[model samples]
Target: MNSGRLTNFLIPLLAVLLGVIAGSIVMVISGYDPIAGYSALLYGAFGDSYYIGETIRQMTPYILSGLAVAFAFRTGLFNIGVEGQLIVGWLAAVWVGVAFELPKFIHLPLAILAAALAGALWALIPGFLKARFKVHEVIVTIMMNYIALHVTNAIIRFVLSDKSYKSEEIHESASLRSEFLQSITDYSTLHYGIIIALIAAVIMWFLLEKTTKGYELRAVGFNQHASHYAGMNVSNNIVLAMVISGAFAGVAGAMEGLGTFANISVKAGFTGVGFDGIAVALLGGNNAFGIILSALLFGALKVGALEMPSSAGVPTELVDIVIALIIFFVASSYLIRLLLTRVKKEGK
Candidate 1:
């Protein structure tokens, strides 16, 4: 890699390293063996097929959610509504998966597409208001989240036959199950959804780097006034960017509802994948390839945390603390850069 590329990668890598080291210190101070805790963490995340499968299952939605947040960040938008978008999308996908009967291929795709559409529609209201009325998107999106929650709850109660907060199991045809793979992984729910997530990431990268539409969207993001002066439709681009971002978030919901969870439950307030996406995007520097690694790290961290309390006698909340430290370090990268520069000068 060139110097600039190397430097960019080094920033986050160093941040993560420092965060891990600090976490180790915390473990030591707490009277736990830091080495043992870390060893257990690694073993829990990658030591067995079951653990690996679970890691992948968790990573699947993370990839999509990371893309969702990353894409919006690229367009200079802070999309805080990913949580609501994902929840509603999950509800829509699960409803369609259970309500429909068709060929497996067709049914599955339809359900996923419905979820994407639902997410896009949810984002559109804020996008439209922001574009047309000059409303602040952040506020509108936050409010939409609550609206999505209550609206979905009411729909589940009155419209669906099932009075339970949960929807019925999706038709087998629409489910993204792989019996052969599941057998190999001891019935872990990792399926074809990983492939879908990868494909979406590739498409997103291509869309951002090699398309006129992407250029227009980014131009508007950089400066709406300049873009408008240049004869570009800034308002339209802003709306379109949010719509596409929401579509990505929606697919994340579909992955969980159709591939991971057999059904959707209204009582399940939020999966938090959308919120996690923000951290993923930030840690990854909003790059497509970076997002993959970031998502994997987070997925492993979560899975490892589940094993920590039982095996290492460390609280699972330690993982959150580590993540927070990592984020803090990343956010203050200038400090790290300055220190590195001072060390280099001293050596010189």
Candidate 2:
């Protein structure tokens, strides 16, 4: 890689390292052993087949959600409604899975496609407002999150009047489970969704870097006025970027619905996956390959945090603080650059 790409990557890595150092300081203040806590963390994430499998399984949705946020950010659109899209998509997938009686192959693909469509359509609302009426996507999408939450709950109540909070469990044919994977992972919830996530990541990278359409989209992201002057349909690209971004988030909902949960439950609040995705996107430098590694890192932190309190008597909340610090550092990368530049001058 060139120096520019390498420097772009180094910033995020520095953020991670600094976050860890800050967490270590917190551990010391709290009278805990930071070394042991991190040791437990590493072991919890990779010590056994079960732990590793669960980490991968948890990261499956994370990968898709991260990609969703990254795609929108790269296209210069803020997609705060990934939470809304994910909820709607989850309901759509489960609704199709249980409502239909088709063959396995057809049913499974149909359910997943339903999720993608639901997510895309939900996102289109904000996209339209931004494109046609000059509404800020951030504000509109945040509002839509609440709307989606209530709408999904009301629909669930209307459809499954007996079960007030959730839909029926989906059929086996519509499930994303792979018994072989589960068995290999000591019966963790790992499934074929991980495969789908990997494929999606590859496709996302290819779409952004290799395609003419993607080039147009990036141009619009860089400067809508310039892109319009260049004869690119700036407005359409806005809508299209959100649509593609939401489509990925919708598949994330599919992973949660069909693979992890096997049913859609009524959530009292937003599923935090979408918010976590924001952090993943930032940490990944809004790039596909970076996002894959960032998702894995966050996934490991979450999985490893569970073992911290029990094994080392350290608070799991330390990890949360670390994540927040990482995000803070990343957002303030100018400070890091200034420091680096001063150090280089001193050396010279």
Best by lDDT: 2
Candidate 2 has an lDDT of 0.88
* lDDT per residue (tens digit) for residues 1-348 in model 1: 985677778877887788788888888887888788878888888878888988988898899898988888888788889888987888889889988899997999999999899999888888888899989888998888888888888787666545777677899988987887788877887888888899999999999999999888888888888999999988888899899989988889899889888787675466678888887887777888988998898788778667777788887677567556665675566577778778768998
lDDT of 2 by residue, 1-348 (tens): 986677777877887788788778878888889899889888888889988998998888889999999999989998999988999989999999989889998999999999999999999999999999999999999999999999998888778446578788999999999899999989988888998888989989999999999999999999999999999999999999999999999999999999998898778899888878888888887888888898898788878788888898886677667556655665566577678778868999
- Tell me which residue pairs clash in candidate 2: none
TM-score against truth, every candidate? 0.93, 0.94
Error of 2 at 268 (Å): 1.7
Q: Which ten residues in a row have the lowest lDDT in candidate 2?
A: 322-331
Q: After superposition, how far is residue 287 of candidate 1 from its true place, in Å?
A: 1.2
Off by over 4 Å in 2: 316-319, 326-348
